[model samples]
Target chain A: MKTNVKVLDCTIRDGGLVNNWDFDVDFVRDLYDSLNAAGVDYMEIGYKNSPKLVDTEGVGPWRFCEDDFIREVIPEKKNTKLSAIVDIGRVEVDDILPCEESSIDLIRVACYLKDIDKAIDLVEAFNKLGYETSINIMAVSNSLGLGLNEALKKVNESPVDMAYIVDSYGSLYNKDIQYLIETFKKYAPNKKLGIHTHNNLQMAFSNTIFSYEQGVEFLDTSIFGMGRGAGNCPTELILGYLNSTKYDVRPILRVIENRLLPLREKLEWGYNTAYAITGLFNEHPRSAIAIRKSNAKNNFLGFYDKLSSVETHEDIK
Target chain B: MKTNVKVLDCTIRDGGLVNNWDFDVDFVRDLYDSLNAAGVDYMEIGYKNSPKLVDTEGVGPWRFCEDDFIREVIPEKKNTKLSAIVDIGRVEVDDILPCEESSIDLIRVACYLKDIDKAIDLVEAFNKLGYETSINIMAVSNSLGLGLNEALKKVNESPVDMAYIVDSYGSLYNKDIQYLIETFKKYAPNKKLGIHTHNNLQMAFSNTIFSYEQGVEFLDTSIFGMGRGAGNCPTELILGYLNSTKYDVRPILRVIENRLLPLREKLEWGYNTAYAITGLFNEHPRSAIAIRKSNAKNNFLGFYDKLSSVETHEDIK
Candidate 1:
């Protein structure tokens, strides 16, 4: 409680990456209640992408996160703040209502460094609408030295309250995290720092702790590390580390037990060699994900050869 | 290839903690062949505990590691150095033949700080027999201030070739690893350093890298991090970091692919909340293992309470 650290339980939102955002409404609602009762600071329910901009069919209610649906699920929001992420160009400006008109309190915009200008515009739009906003720069492992400085400069000038150092590839080590955060501070010095880590190298929890130790405020986590590929750091580990009376780990654990544990069979979303290989090369995990779906799911060497045979930017590093 | 660091793959040895060392002979043989082909510096095939001192029933050949059995498996020993861990008081000294008479290249004694005297005695015995020796100080998280100084002193005076800072509970952070390695250097300055880490807080890879960065030469890893509780650092991750021609990552990947991946369903060994809770407290993972095997396996809160209810030295911290 005394600690300035804030836990954002993005179990539903980030986990959607692994399951195509197909969670049921009941699960999302219960997750909201559980996180609130757990004394977690925030709950990122899901993406706020416009259905018109992307296919909504077969996707869960959490994906669109219409104001009416969120209100219907949790008419009375409790201690936990409600939030959703919007991708650049994925959500129409009209899709975001004034914060006073909706239950959502925070609007997070996740985008690549190439679209930093657009992400900043969205952050400005949401900020003017009475909502706190954050900008997440994805795949920094690959984006470093490639318009990153300019993007960070642009993000620094924006009205974004928080700037997230997203480890989309899960390739960063301690030294790399230090270097990345220092660079982020050089430009976005005034903005609160957030850490969004993937567990490809099993460094997610440690990386999050490293972030907090370096004065980051927001920590993103998923239940049992349920997310795309290697998944995010587990909320349980984060809560356990914080060990604040203000944060109740029991509720987080209960949600994992009652709702998330059973999803393992279909999701297959924890740290594996495929993700580890991609992480090692500092490359995107799209190929690893493809390999996971193919007959060579467990064939690590085949995957390695397949990855090596391909000519790409990641191999140069 | 020229880093002077050594890789010790302990897939069969440490992995025995999960499946009661119930590995088939064919699989061990194939794994031995694979590690040799990979140019891995060392291959720890199994435990060298005396069968008479403990129960051998239901365990496999790896547990006892009979000299005749080892010779039969590796009829013509290749480039990989063969090693085995001997628990103090568990293994009969008469059982160990001279290094030249046996195929084993090294004899490692793993013990708690309280048993350091006994471990040193074993190390001396192994060294006298002309085999390189290392003393693995198990569960240093709980044993840090308790008898550690005395243990390190006795180990330093002993004829041990290497002194290992083992993180049995997988609770150590990079800073803690730094502290422990420095402590070992203080007492055992002349002895070569080694690191054996467990992955409870998901810091095994980072901790291992920290050890290497700190100049610890002997690094212990498993095929797929296949060990007790949260498992050891994966050999694949270690190889990925080394990225040298001396280490062929493909074979490690192949063993994991063709052999180890299939054992995952039967072995629920990896990072999980139960183990994470135990690790956070820097206590033994026996309670977590018990919780894992019980009905409340997925009940994180229940397991948390179960761990909290236990009043021991760990709670004081």
Candidate 2:
């Protein structure tokens, strides 16, 4: 069902976390044009994180998506609107300008369960500045039970235009996505909903589709799944699957052919053994990353032997 | 959850279909040793289809999968059992004789809904010849209503060791997979269940896992998703996700680093727009493939515009 649901391409922003945001201006401009041609609803160019707050030297544009740099990249606006994310702690309030004055149409605020209040503060500031605002609760997998209920209450009361169900750990299944969407809908009936998923579990595409079916208005995607640790669902996948003559797959293909593919050659991301295993265990991927870096003689049989021999214990949290 | 389920690596058999079975002897040997080390229950070396029947003058080894060639490749049997597939009409009974004397341990029969009788006939012959046998009914997506029930009856009467829930069109979702597993269990409770899925819909891994949760014992995978259309679920994904330390991912990774990645540059198989769309539409990906080849002038805004205008439809089946 290709309704009013919008797909926001976040390859540079979220994906930058994987490669330290090493994208060039020409690549970003081409991605913007391509995504616009591909019927993408919005292009999340990068995070508006303060470079001074985080180490930014040699980092990618996504790590520091400055307003002036973004405006310079896309000299003229097209069909797709531009968006940028700001973490509760990483961005300064003064950095956000009115939508009429800046190229960004949407400003998203991301936070953990305990920081929704701080996130709401940013959302309010952005909203007052006349920009579309969303509050994305990261690491929702760890915030099940009562924490979720309280968060939902805050979301309901917030001035945000949209609320996001962020599967930051990439640990959620389809049922979990369904539960989260239904829960959010029940609690915040008046606010629109969005989805931001990671492919650590290979469920990002399905989870996003499930959310769409449940009436989510926005979907977050990347070109070639270029987000952190296993990546985000590929934007081209959504465009192709939706089969809407409105969205062009060529833009995404161009982005892959030009930007993401080269990035892939330089930076190893996407589905790897360690990430897949961590997904299978429903645990954080730190263990898998450690194993990969250790270069422990590639002995799969040995690994399997160790896993099976371990006492069947509680599932990894 | 990682109990008695068995993994069968069919990279040569299934991926051959995508690449015209052009794999070399060395790659096959490496895969065999790696799978053995990883404790994969079975490795499908290739198909047993007759060269004469399929017109294989320049066809690849993976396409033909001759018993003699396979015997020469692996040389010795180890922890992993060797298996070969035979399509109903494409294979001659005489072509299988050497398998009985070779390292082959299983012979699988693949057929469409209309060819169950032919598949059963082959299964019976393979069983009598002292080889593990299975009947894989292809295009189960089109097997609606009585078609499924009728096929189940034939499978119940067959001598096959396992009956497969083949999502040939890559159309089945998780719930659909669960239903098919339940249906097979109801009709052929005495037989084990297997899964053969394509990634056209990106559900191959999730659907395979759903089958496992439903107590289906056999799982099929290919390396780097190197089968037809979007290809099969990546073998490494299955191995890593199964949470079986016994299924070491290194061997699979080694296979990719040494063989599949290079092959990927020459061949154009793997997850793509056409396959993903086909999966989303629950239709064959032939049209999407045609679109990709035609290089039609892309109209991105038009595509999205159409989708946005349409009333939402719930036809993700």
Candidate 3:
């Protein structure tokens, strides 16, 4: 029903955080073909982080989405475009090629509030290279009383094609989302809005739809909600909800059944109480992820107590 | 922050539909104690259906919810009250004891849109015997163009203390929730409202919270979302979100870790592609449930195709 809405499948990029970019080439090829057949607008192949800047010894090819690697995985570009994410200081502009010479069609810059200037600089560079660009502000839930207005104004003044509201901590509720969208619109009125969500409390899908209703044009989703900690909004859910003739959900469902479901045997993601606790406090999920790897994985009460004690200590300080 | 909102735990009642009421007495006792310690306002022990009306050979004691059975399980009543749900034709007035003579504090009648009259009769009977009463209209999404206005008006004129919006098929979105709340307010202005959701699309927690924001007084939840099919909103989520000193989430988290986690080995519930497909079509989950039981459990594409064929055939008709 919505013609302007664009769905970006970030299964390989966002889901990389879960498996350390260990996706097989066959799986990647299947996903690429399925997403194209499903009529998804864009597929974020992976990150474009420079290998020289970060440790990529054990990671897969997705950690550094070289243009040659992308072409090898997906030799032909279909209706779905290609995208890659880059964090500030993790990317080298020299490694990126002009849009006509590369498989990547869009380059998104992910950053925190403190790195807005650098993010805008990279987004401006990517835009100049003839690729669509977006600036994703991570952890906007913790941006309370921070200089979000100023950051949005800075982004608004840039050449960014889209500005994303990323719920990195997965702590936002409907009211917070409403407030953030209003703030974004007020300061960044010149830019299009996008929504990226995490499923720490099973609100990823709902909040994404709520954002769409409030005029967010771009939505970020992944296969089976495979991401760090609690995962992201599921691509199948968004495709099924869209129910447009342009999009076919059957292909998406097939890929999930064939590829993503088997990976669940070794990898763990989705909603858990430990992750929910961290999200409740608007904290990073690194602690929860660590505890899950430890023997106290199921000790949610202990996790809650630890968080409560930290809050108390902070208050005392 | 929300002092007037009441939380109801329906793990045994709604969850009974999944496992056929086969909960152990020890498990039930543990859940009861945990919910009470967690400061839940009410706990729906199970159904009060008459054995003469429905076949109950293999079912557990929860299907009956006899006063003696509840008393045996919970000898002492704490701050949390007890409630039971019954259907229109499956209950007999003589089977119910007076509030002062029984452990039950509330009696809720569940019905479809066409059975509003029968539901109100039961509510009136229960109210006359000094028990809190409510009327839950099931599958209201399918009640489109039905006489919902007439049904709500009839319930508004009854002795029912609460009116519920039950998304029986898990088919509602935010716009539908907003519209339903406004319609319920317009028709049943005097009755306090409650929400009971299904998580087929992973919207139960968000929808419940949205309803609360719109001033719905009573909230229905289950431990780890252990209901039929995709289950209800998780009780732990609401407790964490409420964050009032009156409610403690540690006990709920413990119950989930100890009791509900083990139940996952035998029972398959939660958001799956098959369930999401049925929810998107606004159809009952019987087909999805059946497919989940068959060899085609993971064949989401086949399931989607089957549903599509049926829809096409119906359109021809």
Best by TM-score: 3
Give me the iRMSD of candidate 2, please. 5.8
lDDT of 3 by residue, B70-166 (tens): 9999999999999999988899898789999999999999998888999999999999899999999899887655499888888899999999999
Error in Å for residue B36 of model 1? 1.6
The CAPRI class of candidate 1 is high
Tens-digit lDDT track of model 2 for B93-126: 8657744586789988988778788888888888
Sorting all predicted structures by lDDT, with the top scorer first, yields: 3, 1, 2
What is the C-alpha DockQ of each candidate?
0.83, 0.23, 0.88
Where is model 3 more than 4 Å wrong at Cα? A312-317, B312-317
What alpha-carbon RMSD in Å does predicted model 1 have with respect to the real structure?
2.4
The TM-score values for the models, in the order shown, are: 0.96, 0.79, 0.97
CA lDDT scores, all candidates in order: 0.87, 0.78, 0.90
Determine which window of 10 residues in candidate 1 chain A has minimal summed lDDT: A308-317
| Model 2: CA > 4 A from native | A2-4, A18-30, A33-38, A59-79, A142-149, A175-191, A244-269, A277-317, B2-4, B18-30, B51-79, B94-102, B142-149, B169-191, B244-269, B274-317
Between prediction 1 and prediction 3, which has the larger lDDT?
Answer: 3
Instruction: Please give the lDDT score at residue B235 for candidate 2.
Output: 81
For this target, which candidate reaches the highest lDDT against the unseen true structure? 3
lDDT comparing candidate 2 with the true structure:
0.78
Residue A90 shift from truth in candidate 2, angstroms:
2.4
Query: At residue A236, what lDDT does model 2 achieve?
Result: 77
Q: Of the candidates shown, which would achieve the greatest DockQ relative to the real structure?
A: 3
